[model samples]
Target: MVEVAWPVIHATQVEQVIAVFLSREHPHALRITPSQGDKGLDVIVEQADSTYHNFQVKYFATNLNSSQKRQIKKSLASAISLHNDKDSDFDLSLWILTMPWNPTTQQLGWFRQIQTDLACPFSCEWRGLDYVNGLASKYPQVVDYHLGNDKSRLEQRIKDLENFQRLRALAGMPSADSTLVPQDLLTPLAEVVQAINRDDPHYQFSVEAGPYAPPAVSRPGLIASTTIGETQVGPFVTFHVYARYRHATDDRPLPLTIHLNEAALTEMDRAAWQDAIRFGSPVTLAPGSFTLDIDLPGGLGVTNGEGTLRLFASDLQAPQPGPVRWVIVGPASWSVIAEIEVQNGPATRGVAGGIEFEGIDSTGIMTTRTRATPNPNGTFNLNVTISLAPEQELIGLPVAQALQILRFIDAYKPGNRLAFGPRWEPIVRDSAQLIQIDAGSATALISFLTDLNLVSNECGAPASVPNWRELTRQEFLGVRNAARVLAGSTARLEVHESYIAELAKSDIEMLPKGEPVAVTMPTQFELKVAEQKFVLPFTEISFSRITIESSDQTSPDPDRGFIVFRPMEGCEITQSMPYGAEGDDSLE
Candidate 1:
């Protein structure tokens, strides 16, 4: 075999190439166009004497087999009539069958037999592979016009791939070269993200998945795949994070850690706060970008939140890759409550594309930071934190999602310190089914319960569940001036700003924290708030001996919760103090 630069070509395109070749040969070739009636010849050439020559072009990528030889004889048989229009029958001048494939000895013999059997008056010829090759050499420009050479084809393919990627990207679709992800691998990734949620200190976490488009895409690649292990070209994903972190005035990447294996959610995992995707370790993160990877069954992915992350490197294979990404979206909030977003939806617009949770608190200034890493399961881990102002309410979120988030924070676990305000307080207590709300206004609590459909206008709890038990009017008000007072502990009462210009709880008295109070007591001492009768349970008898305390310098006793005392006769102070004393046990 001699080496030659002959360009490889397609059989279907052979006629087109031949058309150019023949048209070039006879500048005035009378091409039989579709607009005209079907002709026995693909094209015709005029001789000087006005006689015509016929050329029938056929493309056969394979050798002339028996069936093809028979078709050829049939095709040639039609030439018995006039070879030119208006020419008498049997007046065939010349007929040529042009085909791309060379004929074998048997095929040539068959062709000779067909000619002998037809016994036509004019000559018969075959413009097979050898003739076509000689024609190509003689008219190289025509070949180039029809089919480009090797280098041109490669360059064109590159351009095609780039153009396709550009088009898809402009349309917000995944890149043509995008690495699709494995669906089963996504389970672990989703689990890892959940682990980030369980382990990270983000007030709100979410994921913004990049497109998981398969190899089923434009020009250079197949638009749809069926063969096994031929998918997951790329997986582009993003994880979100949000927290309240006070960064120092310097340029430094955030700190984070990620664990891939699914195991117990303990230690910082908050033995009580873990899920199926729980667990992680610590790692450092550069401000704007970071690295991510894990030993996944397939390949890798990319994306970030409130910031950016780039994707490259890794494997992506598994039948067909679904658009699944586990992202730790950072929840956002401007007020007391953060929005807890629902997760996981359709592939096109997963996360439902409803609301984005990027953990940004745009209250006054923007202080969003991020941290991300990868798991061994080809999933990712990301965390974020923002700057928060002092005095703002902690944990303002939807009740249900709030319940879920609360279960994972440091405050919910032992051997941990929960960050609040400027200090990290040691969280010595924990509970799963209970939450403490210290809103002094019963009306506010009632409104909240109403919003959640957990309570009625009359403060009646829903259903027979003891957790939602009913509350009495007086008890609905946070225990003011009450304490966890032991027998020796001193007690104090609080006066709140009047709920109305002239209304107060009558028969006000000392009570235990969360203790139900009586609405009326005939013998209770009363300090009138514009004449709304008020009473204290233990104060009527000690009215004269009771102390009226303020922020005075005389003394400050912290343990002031035991019994309640009332004001002196004719001495009225309408202030409803959740505290009238500065004590550690002050009713708050």
Candidate 2:
């Protein structure tokens, strides 16, 4: 059962390889032969230069494991045992022959197992292709580089036929006797293997023609519109409050709530008015319009024409001002409507304005009258007059400075009621000291502390009038002198000959540590300027230790994400350290 054709082919190939090797060693004899059944040796070759080699040819188109190698070692051991009786001296080099290959981990592990279990001397495994190439390089004359060129062609043809048969089975097709594959079939398979070799399964036609796809975005459209009407009669100028709301395309309604002023409510019947005009009333208007109206009462019940009935349109009224904010939303058809803004007028004198101030503690002041008037409750009326120069008007400073002045007064005095009066009011009405100004300029501001009185000195007396004793002058002044001085000095005035217009803008409030306080502006005045309409969704994403450095670990680029360190969150970044990759000792 020799089936000896393959051995002839292998011997011829070995002959050229041995010849090539002989040329490297001069004056050497070389012989290559097949296995002799008596000795059970696969191949034995002798060199003329007192050298010899033992050969083993492995013809496998697949991988080898540890167990198979162990079997080969067992056969070698048996052959050696049979030859133990003969006395001979033979030097040997073991040569292995196979295709161009390197052993995988499993195959290497098998070779290691053979060494460990069988106690073999050689621990290294050499590739057959490398040995052949090395031999050809060593003995160039006998190498005959093209000796295996025709056999390689035949082997390649056989491999091609086999691969086509395997693929035909995979593709649910029938294999034929034809050796050449169809161009269409071979082209596709070649492309597939190329893609696989490139490690890009995504490029495969089987994966690209999948059924899944990303969802499409949808645009919003106008959904619905409605109208509302109200008509009534009464004697007084009645007040009506209507809530105008809109239902979004998604069916979510945002109701509007507006509080009526005292003037508008004073003349109307509170009981009857609240009954008809309830809270959360929907606003309905003509089609394609966002308008609504509620009829008001006339002088007595009027059913006739031209009766002067108060007509109140809900759209005519502006939203109540808050925190001095302003905004404009539009559909691009009409002029921009200011959705938020403060009403600027002198009417805010008695009423509250956008600016507000609350007292922190009590304060005091003194007058030059040197007299105390008695009241109905027998409590003395301590009137103080803190004077300013004729040109020193106090109505020009920013209101915030005025507030700080009030706080300063409170720190000086513990419990004193205060008010800021006009310049024409008594500067020395009751018992007060005159604060003579060394600097006569109108814009000259009084310092918080001075030589005469420790103005803002927590442990010292007043700077304007220092002689007064037994009077806790800190709680003496009724008018807010500090606020007045602040309002006068730091403030800018828009003078119109008769009346002064406040033009000075207030500075942002400073926290204790000189940081700007995050105060919420009034809903009426905040502005959102964006390149395009973008909704800032309600999301809280926390960023922890953005400046993390791990030279020993792998990390992606820090600048490649949500940019955790935003400039606005008060992240006062001066410099950033460079990031190093894992195992990168180049920086060293």
Candidate 3:
């Protein structure tokens, strides 16, 4: 008999208990992870070595509440839905197991009252070790379902759930939700249910014989690691890991360990060494429950201007939840080996290959640097550099390897530090990504800014701290001229009193320069793609020499990515208007 232990187990426990019995009692058998789309069951056993029985597993908290009862009802409803599909004629036998006695006074009454209302191939049984003696006394054949037995499917399922839950806690996302038979899979589910519904197509399904014997349980295995986020901190690298597990008891701390390649660790650019420890708030492992978190680092903004950290895990040890490795990228001058062992134990060369960044920050913490610019055509150009400490050199990192390095470092060592070299390349498009600016039109400019809700600060804030007086068209134009100084990152296309000083400077610059430049001022521009439209407004007309090769630093590479416009032919400029000047929608 299957012996399943956990903080909770839903219907799947009952399936395992039954599997244990059938595996021994019947012939021509093999097991399959039950319900390809069903999350509740661990596996299903069939008679002809083909799909037949649809089993489910469930984990319930000791304190059953109205909500949980509702969930159970929901799960059952989904099972019925699956069974009703126009598929095979396999009979349905769903089993739900708890720690032992379950169902509150009200719930038990509800279950008793609603038993008939529940659909076919659906049944609920609540029993535990205490009931084992009843089987031994009356039906010794069901002994396979007992908990203490080896090779029991129930035991294995419990183990698998335990490990699955543990890793899930680290990943920080919910366990895989119930497998809704997508419309595509509905046909298959239908065929399976059609075969099991009845002996004759006209006859109704019947569970004439009571459960012949209890099913066996199998030990569930440890879950694999999942990566979360990665960031660079000078030379150090950090990674986050997640997995899941099932617990056999309550409040019991699960012994865990992490493994990483030592060679990769020693070769990583490490600023300094810090103790390795768990990365997040501690959690208690409850039976049948699964948890998830930011399992492996790679999380945005987890690194700083320090060193990159590299990681590796020990392959020999059983998997557990925790940080695996934390290695700092060292300086370029240092002499470090390419490989090392886990916990400084062994070494491997391939692990050291990957791109890495290094450098010193303005704060004196080591950091890396990279340059990025937008193209006039609206794409981005990125220059990234990777640094490695003496320790990171042995591996002579590859680009993909470098990504993993950043993940580990960011997870363990986090800060508002800068990254240098190739690591700092911008992944996002500049302000031009969603909007464009037109040149030399006042109404266009005003409408654009209006759409964007942008306002400038030419007139200083009135007596009110946050409110600034609205500048007139001329004043707003002047503010646009001085925007470079008045607002750097803070500047938008509108006018504000706080920017008055900068606007004055701009006014002076715009009057006249020694050489004649084809000066054009920015107007508001709007774009429509599909059904959605976006508007951009600007006060200043940014002019550039229309180079033979489009000069938009942020524009996409013409050869590789999309380029928006063709080479500019001589064009007419019918208008030289101020910020408030009105104009027809059609360009003259």
Greater TM-score among 1 and 3 belongs to 1
* lDDT of candidate model 2 versus the reference: 0.29
Query: Per-residue lDDT for 480 in model 1?
Result: 25
- TM per prediction: 0.24, 0.19, 0.20
lDDT of 1 at 536: 33
Q: Largest lDDT belongs to which candidate?
A: 1
- Give one digit per residue, the lDDT tens place, for model 2 in 94-195: 433332234677765765665476444322244544554554444332333324332223564565567666666656654574444456466656754443
- Residue 89 error, candidate 3, Å: 5.7
Error of 3 at 576 (Å): 99
Off by over 4 Å in 3: 1-36, 39-42, 47-55, 93-106, 112-115, 121-124, 128-588
Clash number for every model? 53, 32, 208
Better of 1 and 2 by TM-score: 1
